[model samples]
Target: MDTEQQSQTKSEFEREPVPKSALLGFKSFIGMYAGEHCAGTELMLGPLFVAAGVSAFDLIIGLLLGNALAVLSWMFMCAPIATRSRLTLYYQLEKICGRKLVILYNLANGVMFCFLAGAMVTVSATALGVWFRFKMPGLNDLYPNSVGWVVAVAVAGGLIAIVAAYGYQTVAKFANIAAPWMVLVFLVFGFVGLRQFIEATGTEIGSLSDVWHLAKTQIWKGGPPQEGQVKFTFWHVTFFAWFCNMAMHIGMSDLSVFRFARKSWYGVASGAGMYVGHFMAWISASILYAYQLHLNPADTDVLPGPLAYRAAGLVGLLCVIIAGWTTANPTIYRAGLAFQALSPKSSRFKVTLITGAIATIAGMFPAIAMKLLGFVALYGLVLMPMGAVIFVDFWLIRKFGMQSYYAELSGKTFNWAAGLAWFVTLAIAWVLVKFAGVQIFFVSLPGWFVAAILYIVLSKFYQKKLRPDAVQ
Candidate 1:
């Protein structure tokens, strides 16, 4: 590609509102959410819950409530403003925060995206390891086991990156096609795994009540957490399910996604992902893990490729690979937009390619992906405060008689109030986790409120002191 083409920022619009012509139908969102949620991460995450020592009731009931909350967060917290403003999260933040502050936030956002995409690459590479009979990362492993594993990840990352570099249109198309098939495969994994458990154990099952009994006794039997895993109670499961994608919905990163919607109600389409991916897929994947435990009783490895391969043979491996690709493509694409925002003059495609390379390198280290439960929570927490900033600036600021987009109106290159609120909320959250003994999952919701209140209050004093005439 020519330098001009390479440097083009095709979709990361920094100034203009998205045109009405680009609005997508609700079904487009359904397909996107379904594909993104019922993905490679589900394979890894399902097993992690099993390690967390959750009972059947906690898992089932918690997920029902959690998934409902997640969908509502999208519909109420993210979608309305996204459709009204029709701007990418980066551009929107740049308007509220100064360009300099937004740049730093974008860097953090991009890095998180790279790491997340890296984890997906790792999940898919496991399938390649199964196919080629090469060494793969094992449970508790921190690094790539062999050269073959690295090669597999690099190959997968390269293809996924190229697809992402093409932009969101292609990514959505790929996901729309993959989501239904992957969901079907995931269901099969659960059913086949359940049958194996029944046959191998000779468990009597004549009715739904019998199945519930088996679930409590054998499948989701609650006990001490596995080594290094925390015990998850009903509340923990509920909160984790709701906030698993906290950064995207409540954190407002999905502003970019929902900006294309024809109406705010299209945000309700997120229910497709929440119910299908987080609820059903999560439960099914957990069942597979439960069956694995039944078989060996000692093997604690959480290898998705091997688990699936054992269940449905090669079809399972293919599901792992496809699921990873579908998730990683859009993630890398978003990461590229963040990077490109740092250098608006640069080519988005080249930026995305670089982001993909970073993800590929991170994928070589298996520790983060294996401990994905905690890592995902941390990543979401990091980006979440900014979402609060956006929310306050958009709706609450004017009501509070504070200037919205003060930085943009003042021609300031940095907004201290927004920046301070962003970091201080995180620091306070960290203190709660470290000193106050609050869990990571529990801190995010309060952290968001802390950020919103801090931003508004600080903006009042800071603006009055710095720009008295500007404050209403």
Candidate 2:
């Protein structure tokens, strides 16, 4: 192979199983998950929970259970398949869903990734607004409020894309470097916010009970939601915490990440992220936002830049920027892989750079980030059916008297069974959320079972029609 060809092959193990030599140790995933999960979203989500009227008990216990579930899903649902197959989710889907159908899935997956990365960019940009004294968007504000905000997003997103275009090892290295420092900064935010609350409320810090008392009465008071915010209960908090990263864990997007793992058990490293980022970081951030609300009720904006700065000063601002960058880097890399899967001939480096550019453009629009609570729920729901399809195809299809990887075995360009399982499950999810009055956050739970069953039943009929002799 020429030098150029070698570089392209090294871009990612796109069309092939990752060689044994390329497999990563457990620490890499620990760092990556910790850095990625304890990120810009934490700043937004922590605040959003308060906006949604989550009580102290609900937020605390709910996050405990929800994060535990998220780790298990990553361990059992995603990592087993990733380690066994050592293939990217896109490539694995192509084997089962066929080339044409996989293209549709990739497009959806990649676009969602771009928008998500864009939200992170918006988060980082908010930090810049504080320094430059630019007008930032409000909780309900959708469009770019100032030219400075746009420029900030562009700079942050551009740098993130360049790093992502270098590929996975680089992404992991960046995460490792940032994770420890970011974790400490987040802790400081909690302490600073707690001190402010204590001073303002005149609460005596006698014991843990006092802290709980402060948390109950002042921080998360269990009141009605702000205008336009959804009311959140314990179930809502638990489900949101569990399924917030549903796309990455249950939706099987992390197949690309975990495919590099030496053992499926490495999935447990997600706990480092779940506990530190999702649990501690979220509580800390919510503390800052809650303090802001305590001081003034009318100021109902969810801006991380100002929120962090108020807690830790310049250090807090820097944390917000770096946190967003670390998260966006791997996200853009994954999005690039999804896009590259569509046209295997395209260069992943270039595709990633382009993908980052798209995310940057998206970051200029505040709608996705401002309405992040709903958007994250919807993002996971749209992609989650595919995960169910993957789960069934891997573990259940053969037991049901059907051939697995039907598209690959039959040389078909489109596997209608897999395609229908994806689309039909989504259709049912829509019905439940639309007319049946199921919130988007909760719909994905039942939807997963529905997709699994749909895939099995549809595969039985599909295989019988296509290859009668192949069906037992």
Candidate 3:
């Protein structure tokens, strides 16, 4: 086949392994990651650090360590497996977890992605709220409060969905175009916010040390959390930074994204996103929020639209909308893939549109976006066990004298071992979070180990009993 035909074939190859001829260069991934990670959500997350009462040292040091760990997880844990298999996470899961079990996982993953996209839709809609002068939901609001809010979300969500339905290359292209400008705008938010803070406090800045001192005293001053926020420590900041994208990295969702890469080392491209989006964008956003609080403590609403507008006027407002779009496009695309896995013969474009509609509806509810910190933590926890299952199945199952891809090898409709590992691990996580007083943020780390161990032990008994004679 010609290169064009091969590229087209690869784009539509949902069930089959991606051909080597269709693999993408490292630059494609870098652009995608930078654009996707430097997202609308950073607007929410940065302000959230201020609300959580994080100190400067804790937030900075924590993010550095956490983001580094996150990049490493992508490189070592996810990318290698993706390059070797050249299949979507759904397809790979189907081999080990079986068709029925994979359907459940895909549903869980799809719903979560939809909600995440919905949150981004909400962020973008807030930008509209600024332009239209509408009443937006507050930090504690659970539902849409006004007709304008609903319309804004609907319009933004519709456009974003259309872009996402065009597929990954389009998504990457859009991200590449927007990423550089969005990053610059985010930096402006920081500089503008710092100037505002300095002017307000009459603080004279002479060097980097002065800025650090200002950041410590004025921006991320350590104290009690705002109303309805969890107190943030260094560990909380670190873990939140690391595991915030746990579903993508540690949970193996990015297996789909990385499968198109020319090399496993392309995973390192994730550093662009981690540093630019998760680090710089986050800090800049936090500065903006801190300045807002400095101006009016009672204006506690965490709206990215108005916040950006206060700093850079119309350009900032435009940044909020595009930032949200860049993030949501890829997210909705991922969700579409998850849903498509359930009905392999279905039209991807149509499925993606439907998924986008669901996300738009969910976006009308403000609670998901308002409670995003907890929500994202829960999102990762819910999906992380399967990652452990995938890890163990791919690397360890054979070493333990059991057949890998047990479901595929045995032609089973469901693999009880993988299923139990997923379900039981969640159960354990729930127990730890509910009764053991463990915070949700910290539970997934130990839970990953639990899932891995459970998968290994359960697979042993399962393979022995079901296929004793076929044991390798």
Best by lDDT: 3
User: Which structure among the candidates has the greatest TM-score?
Assistant: 3
Looking at model 3, residue 377 earns an lDDT score of 95
Query: Which residue runs of candidate 1 sit more than 4 Å off their true CA positions?
Result: 1-14, 18-23, 162-172, 347-349, 465-472
- Model 2 poorest ten-residue lDDT run: 1-10
CA displacement after TM-score superposition, residue 252 of candidate 1 (Å):
1.1
Tens digits of per-residue lDDT, candidate 2, 303-400, equal: 99999999999999999998888788878887897789778899888999999999999999998888888889889998998899899889988887
Model 3, span 206-261: residue lDDT tens = 99999899999999998998888899999999999899999888999899888888
Q: Evaluate all candidate structures by whole-model CA lDDT and list the values in order.
A: 0.85, 0.88, 0.89
Q: What is the TM-score of each candidate against the true structure?
A: 0.91, 0.90, 0.92
- Winner by lDDT between candidate 3 and candidate 2: 3
Q: Candidate 1 on 17-57: residue-level lDDT in tens? A: 77776566777788667767887899999888988889999
- What is residue 396's positional error in candidate 1, in angstroms? 1.7
Arranged by TM-score with the best first, the candidates are 3, 1, 2
Who is ahead in lDDT, 1 or 3? 3
Descending-lDDT candidate ranking? 3, 2, 1
